[model samples]
Target: MSGSTFALRVAQGVGFTGAAWLSGNIAALSANSVPAIISSVREDNISPNVACKQWRNMYEAGKTQNPPIAFATASSFAYVAWSVRQIPRSLAASAAYGGFGMYVAAAVLTLSIVPYTVAAMRPTNNALLELAESKGDRVTSSAEVEGLLGRWTTLNWARSLLPLAGGFAGIAAALL
Candidate 1:
């Protein structure tokens, strides 16, 4: 096989794996980790301050980890699309063009979570971070912390869908 063929295969593999990994990581946080933190506060097992601080720690960790995954996944998808584009149309069938489209879409969708977070989720994140920094003193009651946490969870759930969609697109491309 040619170098371009090898690169295309590598890009496809990286894009699919990275997209799935990022999506699963986000979903795990949304489904299990965040809820457990909120549950601790709700059950009074931990003070709201402690819960917020714990949440902040998790959020910070994700901030460090997730962006790189997203970017790498998107870059891989973009590279796959570029590689697909390099194939001569006479040799590349209609399915190859379709895969190229899907790869491009995958790249866009995978990267979209970053802007989505900035636009849709930043306010809640900022508020939560503030509360965490204040040791929960900024809020009137534990309920407020719970509300923010719930909102964050909901937003995160939505955010998780972007990479999931990208992964699905990647799968669709591979099938094509």
Candidate 2:
């Protein structure tokens, strides 16, 4: 048993499982809501400014939140635990060991979203925030915000897909 402390294994399990659930939820939530934004504007002819404003507010609020805190914390702990000692392993424990590796991969991949967001999306995000703050509800029609929103929508998919992968990895870990 490679001195696989019960506590370390448990923490790894939590980290990977939490990553799966949290990342999956974040990805699903983003995907589900994006269509609604587009639909509401096209179907109802709602103002783009209003939509942008809503999105800006949501982004601002979400920025302060940590949806992946559980995954992060657990993963961090698991990493630390592993640094001290690799989780004990054997062919019999392949399911768990493999799953743990996947979870770690998930964490690594999920973190990759930061660079894309910072490089590609942050500019547009900042502009949208400023526009919403300065213009508020007065801007009429959706055309004004289309390009930024479009870019945002597209880049967001990149951010979301990794977590989805992590989530599936977590599921594998949990089952195996």
Candidate 3:
């Protein structure tokens, strides 16, 4: 019922929604034929087979991206909540140990936010590379420069803020 618990629930809900959306997209792509994929890719102005390949590649890249870090931070926040819940019913000896445990848990939880933020901020080079290749452009400043710059700039902006927001959340969790 506390604010941190509410925030953690929100984070979990968002994560689940994202995971579901990604899974659904993957399934839809998988069920489509090669030609369908190719046509879709071409319609999007990307290379042949890039749709299927990029889908799988991006998914793999995300495995090492922001989601895992967010999940870890959320999990740690949940643990902190549980630890706080334990404090009131504890005996003197139990209170001391439990309080120490809670502090440790909070610190660990806070520490986890850093990695999550870092992961979120870090650009997915694989995605960028695939996009670059699909465009058949050597330098990003070519005729297809807009596409290249757009993608990179969008990702860069996301990376810049993710860590800061994550760190703020971690500090908030610790304070809670």
Which candidate achieves the best lDDT against the true structure? 1
lDDT of 1 by residue, 1-176 (tens): 98878888898899999998898999899899988998887786687778888999999999899998999999999999888777777655888899899999999999898999999999999988887788334553678888999999999999999998998998898898
- Model 1 Cα shift for residue 6 (angstroms): 1.5
Candidate 2: C-alpha RMSD to true structure equals 4.4
Query: Candidate 3: where are CA atoms >4 Å away?
Result: 1-65, 89-141
Model 3 pairs in collision: 121-159
Instruction: Judge candidate 1 at residue 118 and give its lDDT.
Output: 96
Rank candidates by lDDT, best first. 1, 2, 3
**In model 1, which runs have C-alpha deviations exceeding 4 angstroms?**
135-139
Q: Is candidate 1 or candidate 2 better by lDDT?
A: 1
The residue pairs that clash in candidate 2, if any, are 20-167, 48-141, 48-142
- Encode model 2's per-residue lDDT on 21-122: one tens digit a residue: 655545553676656766778898777776777787667655655445643744654463354335466664766566667656655664555565677778
Clashes of each: 0, 3, 1
lDDT (10s digit) by residue, model 3, range 2-104: 8866765565344334333433332332244323544455466664335435544554564465456545544544554564545555456555454445534
**Quick one: best TM-score, which candidate?**
1
What is the overall TM-score of model 3 with all chains considered together?
0.34
Angstrom error of the Cα, residue 150, model 3: value is 3.5
